[model samples]
Target chain A: MDRTEQERLITENRRKRELRYIATFVLMAVIFAVIVVLNINTGSVKISVPEIFRVIFLRQGDKVKYDIIWSIRLPRIAMAAILGGALSLSGFLLQTFFSNPITGPFILGISSGAKMCVALSLIYYIQRFGHSSSVIMILAAFVGALLSTGFVLLLSRKIRNMSILLVGGIMVSYICSAVTDFIVTFADDSNIVNLHGWSLGSFAGSTWTDFYTALAIIGVCAVVTFLAAKPISAFQLGENYAQSMGVNIRLFRVMLILLSSVLSATVTAYAGPISFVGIAVPHLVKRSLNTAKPIIVIPATFLGGAVFCMFCDLIARTAFSPTEMNISTVTSIFGAPVVIAMILKRNGGVKQ
Target chain B: MSEYVSASGLTVGYNGRPLIRDIALSIRRGEIVTLIGPNGSGKSTILKTLTRHLAAIGGTVTIDSEDLSGITYKELAKKMAVLLTDRTRPELMTCRDVVAMGRYPYTGSLGLLTEEDQKLISDAMVMVNVLELSDRDFQNLSDGQRQRVLLARAICQEPQVIVLDEPTSFLDIRYKIELFGILKKMAIERNTTVIMSLHEIDLAEKISDKILCVKGDHIEHFGTPEEIFSTGLIGTLYDISPKAFNPLLGSVEMPAPSGEPHTFVISACGSGIPVFRALQKAGKPFAAGILYENDVDWQVAFSLAAEVVTEKPFEEISDEAMRRARELIDACEEVILCPVPVGSVNARLRELINYARNAKPCREA
Candidate 1:
């Protein structure tokens, strides 16, 4: 074809890509809004949509509805959205680090590592001081996350095969969970009550303080990750190409590991090892966007994760009415299938 | 012209030990320099060191009078682009997206392509004849198409120098020619320096302005293709029988049947090559006669025939050569006559054919 025609075709493709991005983002935003409203309106108190809005925006509803909106449901919604975005972004970074789509923070045992550390610290601090601070939990989780991430990195060095690395990560996850379960089993009765609720993964009891802390951590990390879109995009081509493109591979790799660790650690500290959101959200978002360009995928993934988790959280809260399911249960139900389907599709594509 | 890319006393290897040491190179802008060597001969190690994928073990490389060690990777990227042999299986990326990645060094912080960047990307795709595949997914392209797209990516970087490691490894003959043709055009038109490693010595001889023959722990020979190809250095470089490779035609032939001649072939004008090969494959050693040194048949016969009686170019068969041919026909068990025109220059071949017919059982090939 002629040059003009070629240019026209390229321009048309770009336009189509942009349209897809805009449409996907719009759809995600609409879904996010719907989930937010649903989460706020569908709790045990049975607040109406208008009453929920009044309590949230106008601040002039029944005292009980206002308290529920401000004190409980709103904080829970914010925590779920922020932590969910954090978890998914963490997964995306890990996928980029390993150059494998199926590997994520959860699959790599990072969340469980954080869970183990948080469990250890919760038992120690609550036993010694009667109550533990969120800061201590986050710090402990960060240490645990880094420890697990460090182990995974070492394994990755020794094992270049991605499947084996994933298997190794799963083994690490199992070890960390076994240790956490051993500790939880022997902890005091009161501590068990607190740890049991947190260990199973729930957005319940998320205070405004927890929401603000997660927002601060994840917001900073998300912006830093967004700023790093160029390198991450280059990295999708793999290390050699990324280096040729001027990315300092060693430094960029360290940054990816550290950033992902922090993000997953924060999520684990808040919501106790939510499963599959990391692996599933980024994959689904990239599929929907029809491009893996990090400049678009990063934000779209964050929003997609928010929508997915908020929807999952809504179910976790109201699925059995008075008896809430764990957030992990809800996420696994929706997200695990996506992961399995992705693996099957990948295998099919490879066979073809 | 002053050398644009020069390396001296360069020692390169993995870890801290040396694989190839004390290598020296001087290449001007627009020169296509190729490293030709056998497998595991440190060609890739040298290329990787030059591209800064591996740190130089010792010594230095300078580009445009600036020390390579002094240049940061980002600065180096602006000057030198490389196409590695690694297969990049980027997910969900279209051909255009892959080519656009060449703009990494030039694009802004967020890597949004400007109109000029897009234009350059498309122009690169056009240069490599992959523009038509602009919308296709990169992973779905054939190996040849992928190589071309990757070359376009390197070209789109618009670097002063391009380094590629075995860029033609997976390409078939047609794509190989096309790839080198594009490289040559890029070098001549844009004055971009091309440095790469190639396994095909024939193509390397034809395309490279400078051929760096790598072997052992150092550069065995580094000079123009004429200097390298004429010295019979390729045979020793690849550890093959010197007779197996024809430096003139840049072709390799299997070793000639290793025995005394059992068949005498009477042929001229390029007709004897297939008969010689068939006899060689059947393990029947043969002797060929009355070929001018300049004849195309002589190229193959010189490499594959057990013995060839030759006359000088532009000369008819001498009496002495004909005597030797008759003696050979007398010794052979059979005579195979390949079709040849009875031209005035080679009329003497007809006499040998007739003589062979009488002395031994003759068969037409």
Candidate 2:
């Protein structure tokens, strides 16, 4: 009630908050380490942990084991982590940009649009030159993502309702998917199989080059988002308040769109489009951290996405021993429930 | 110093067309200015334009004598703050966090609160009596409490001028009074110019140094509340019937119970207010009388009573007045007497009360 008593209580609350945040970050780090170790160790044709470590650290092991780690398993694991982080961080940025918790690259059809463009480019390049480069795929995905984002942005300007905007996004997504289907149906047989695996969204047969490309794009975007924490915090109040707080709204908006698009595009180019992580991981990170301040949530969201996707990738690889489930299938199983819970939690607060 | 905030030839409206044009205003530092007008008269549009929430279709607003369009948003933010009617429901933010956001112009890249910023926030919460609410989620607060918390946020901004649009609309009496008090203190103590639109003309008359009357397609009047209220401008500005608002008492009443007089009320010194109300609600045409002009009862009585037999304030009861009061009492079918102190200056009511007590047609209620 009085000044002295209230200050003491706030101080205690701050102390408790500090401990809680520390515990959460430490827990996330621990989970991330555990999932990474388990992913590398528990794959098919298992190499023992000591042999895996010797192969990873000492650069010496059985030739087959070495090939699996260097050429197959290691790159696959790295792609999963890097692309997963990219997806969730993009989701976080979109959620902030729209000021809606449920918005993400996947739900907004950004990934689907990117997949369509990547498919088109792959078919054109492979049919003409007998080859397709990662650079071209990333560029095509980026262009497709911008197209979808542009549609959503124009639609959002006309409609303030999130559900209507989501419907528009889905419609745009459907058109792109239909066109991709037409391409797949007409493509020559060899490229058709490659398109099937990429469209279904997978982390298989990933190479070191794909891993490095995803790492560079995601890392830069994530850091920029973190640096924008102050404006993002103000933005949570609404756009007017964010502008009133000295944020250059026009520039800030363009940056958010560009960065989020690049991150999601990188994910799509590397792993097709993983579902739900873009919508779910940011929610989980903010929930665990108990704060949505971008300075903290952005990094935690990246780590959370890494841990979640790695775990899902493990199940996708080992669920049937050799018959791998699609990575999107695995993510939807775990991440869709979180999304459903978010919807229920939101609707539960409204009275009939 | 030049006026803290002023607009000249300002035209404000939606979608780039002017709703009210050629508006000019000048508010001094440490002054509280209020805008009062009829609904749909564009008071809010004017406030919005002044706050830069809506761009002015034409003309310019000068803040601290600087051309508004020339000022950067960051510089303007350091000099002014605005609170509009749009309810901002920021999820997962505590009241303190909402208030702390007022330090945006001063905070670093991460928006972390410095020690001095925290002190300003705490002091603002104390002023608004929301110290205990600091840790509570902002969305969970009741409307009145939420209003106070927002006032605290505006205070934390430490701007030279604060513009609020309809600041008292949803608040109860206590919150309204407290908010006005806080606004007044800020204007005087911090030398912050306060500009806001209020629906309460009565409160506006009491609180504002300058009142802007908006009506029709133009800025109607801008002057002291004395000049505005004494001219009985509010009723005309609002298109209200003459009897609906009593400018002298700063109160409102139903259109005087019209028709032939059927009941007489004997009262003076503010006691007849309830009796007049009851008679008005019952739809009984009443003639209420025998009072000094200065009595608080006269305003409502003058509004509701079919005929008010009156005497001048502080004047002795004349024979003519007593005769008029007795005649009205006799003509009435029923008499209602209000229990008022029998004073010497206007003891004429005693004769009327005795007559009612002896032969009152109503049940002496």
Docking quality (DockQ) for each candidate: 0.80, 0.65
Which regions in candidate 1 have their CA more than 4 angstroms from the true location? B314-319, B339-350
TM-score, every prediction:
0.97, 0.95
Candidate 1 lDDT, tens digit per residue, A257-297?
Answer: 98999999999999999999999999999999999999999
lDDT for each residue of candidate 2 in B1-365, tens digit (9 for 90 to 100): 56778899999999987899999999999999999999889988898888777888999999999988788888888888877777777767788888888898998878888889989999999999998898888878988788788778888989899988898977999888899899989987899999999988889988999999999688779999999988767778998887787777778788766788899987777788988898899998989888778888888888899998888888888889888877887788888767778778767667668877676575444
Fnat scores for every prediction: 0.80, 0.58
- Kindly report which residue stretches of model 2 are placed more than 4 angstroms away from their true locations once superposed: B317-331, B340-365
- Against the true structure, whose lDDT is highest? 1
The lowest-lDDT stretch of 10 consecutive residues in candidate 1 chain B is B340-349
TM-score of the B chain in each candidate versus the native B chain = 0.96, 0.93
Strongest candidate by TM-score: 1
Model 2: chain B TM-score relative to the native chain B: 0.93
lDDT of 2 by residue, A1-352 (tens): 6798998897788778778888988998898887777877877778788888899999998999899888988899888988888899999889888888888998898999999999999999999999999999999999999999999999999999987898898898898899999999999999999999989999998999878877888888888888988888888888777766677788999999999999999999989988999889999888877777677788888888888888899999999978999999999999999999998998798553
The CA-based lDDT of model 2 is what? 0.87
In model 2, how large is the Cα lDDT of residue B90? 74
